[model samples]
Target: MPISDFRKKKLLYVFNVFFDVNQSGTIEKKDFELAIEKICTLRGWTPNNPKYAETHETMIKIWDGLRQRADANKDGQVSVDEWCSMWDDYAQNPDRALEWQSRYMNFMFDLEDASNDGSIDVDEFTTVCSCYGLQATECKTAFNKMSKGKEVVSRDEFQELWKQFFSSEDASTPGNFIFGKTNF
Candidate 1:
């Protein structure tokens, strides 16, 4: 689905608030690197782990995706102006964003779907949710809610939840629990 103008504007604000980890007035490489590190630490995904290489690679790919899509000046960072401009451009020409966003979501789903079973179970959900510093019990409950007793989440369902997570205003939405606080 294409991002609507309101959603695009909202997302621009959300990105700046959430991703400017350094609070340096810009989204820089250091900020991204720090975020990746914090995620790995929170998840206890370390270099010594068997899945470390794959996890590290995915993080790198995510950073690259951000830079490739928005680092307008090629300065390895995204200023507020650059970030807003990028989203404004995307809002006018949303087709391009759809492709990139779809690819990113697919890549994330594939990475977390370790069994390649076309769906994600509790374990898979835990793996993805770990980065958010969520407790196992909390994640399990959230997964149950999102799964609605199916005990597995299909790709389409996950995509819908992803969108909901980003755009929904309702505080109690199931997708809101998939990661950290959505209200912020």
Candidate 2:
């Protein structure tokens, strides 16, 4: 499914964090140098901590994959043009994209899954949405619908719902609850 520019821009900005690490408005190899520490913090891990070795490794893999795809020229860096074009990074490989999408969702889950129970409750969901600067209450209805009375969202639920949120034209798809505002 084709993604809207608005959403693409939003997601792009998220990706931009890695490339624009120095906030210079462009992606360079140096930007990735700080990724390990940042990714550790994002995953609630401490750098040089062995307990998080696995998670940290996965994060590195993800970053490596992004760099490989975005740095198309193999010139050791990805400029804004190359970074924005990252939308097509996996366009030719839906299965691979799906796998990456699962990891993306896992990262989101890790961010919001404070309980570490492998699911997101209303409070947890609200907290994650709040981080995006959206009003927490605004997503209650959508969360309710997505949770379907389950009161929590599992990994499978989040991944599938997120995919829909990324591509589904259906207004009722649970993906809309992701940010609490799907008007875009």
Candidate 3:
């Protein structure tokens, strides 16, 4: 099927956002936000209440996945080399692309496991954000907004989010990796 204009635009927007954030060869949470805001604004996606804190908090949750993949070393920071490693691997092998996606999803689950006892909590939410390049204070604020009255995302919920965020129509491209469809 030929791609629809709307889908094309959305895909382009997604690529643009990722390109902008990775332009410096480093991914920072703030830059990630800027990219998201630009795309969201272009798509006219307003939050339920349009609160900056709430929006930022939600974004932190999303960033948790990508940041974890980029970190590679689990050092709480994404270095340029780590970022390059991710991009290179994805570029060279379809299997590597799928592997990265799985790793990212796994990291999200791990980060949400709070209590050090294997449960999700507010602190873990904050830690997830900080791991992505947000300052501690910023992460704390975002975590507060995100964790307010919300239960930890279940495994099913996590998988759903993973598919929603990563699925693409270009799954048939022989050399291009579609996040969930590509088996690695």
Candidate 4:
């Protein structure tokens, strides 16, 4: 059977993530964050500040949205089977492709807000790092040194720092597209 457009795009998104992390054979927080950033750029949306993105309230909102689709039975939580089913359904809905895309983008931001709090904390930072198979210690160290008065990293500060972290020498060259190279 032919795949639906929605499913095709969803699969593409997953494939992109898998391809990026295939070298490590695990999806880490960095991988997830990169994927989210890429998706946001494609959609012309600005990603949340990394320092404050993983708040409990934000996470809760994100989890609630995902649960709404993943938990068809109105359960408060999603089992592995339910999650898989939602993923499968998303991959196959050509008719609602745009809606699915929107949901996926929203979910990424929500996931970053790991704590379900309105604000992100150090623990949330660690959780995000854990997802990317990276140590949060470095982030913690940097954050501690920089944050003198504020408990949370402001959006502007985080964005400026995140840019420095992700920037590469070749990043300035636009449209230097290479075919068949899947890793972004």
State which candidate has the highest TM-score. Answer: 2
Report the error of model 1 at residue 26, Å: 5.4
Candidate 1 on 1-184: residue-level lDDT in tens?
Answer: 5555544545654465446777788877677677667655655778788566666666567667777878888998877666666655654544345454566567667756778999989888776665445577776777777676678888888877766655565656666555423333
Once superposed on the true structure, which residue ranges of model 3 sit more than 4 Å away at CA?
Answer: 1-25, 49-59, 72-77, 91-184
Q: Candidate 2, 43: how far from true, in Å? A: 7.2
Tens-place lDDT digits, model 2, residues 1-184: 4555755654555555424666777666455556555555655677567736766566656666666667788876666667546655443443456444566567777766879998888888776565444677765665787777688888878877666555544666666566555344
Worst 10-residue lDDT window, candidate 1: 175-184
Compared with the true structure, all predictions reach lDDT values of 0.65, 0.62, 0.47, 0.41
Query: lDDT order of candidates, best first?
Result: 1, 2, 3, 4
lDDT of 4 by residue, 111-145 (tens): 44455554445555445534444456654543444
Indicate whether candidate 1 or candidate 3 has the larger lDDT. Answer: 1
* Winning candidate number (lDDT): 1
RMSD of each: 5.1, 4.2, 14.2, 14.1
Question: How accurate locally is residue 83 in candidate 4, as Cα lDDT from 0 to 100?
Answer: 45
Off by over 4 Å in 2: 1-3, 16-22, 27-45, 48-52, 77-84, 88-100, 129-150, 169-172, 179-183
Q: Write the per-residue lDDT of candidate 3 for residues 10-69, one digit (tens) a residue.
A: 334333334336554455676657855654453345765354444456557656765777
My TM-score estimates for the predictions, one after another, are: 0.59, 0.65, 0.35, 0.31
Q: After superposition, how far is residue 106 of candidate 3 from its true place, in Å?
A: 17
Quote the lDDT for 115 in model 1.
Answer: 85
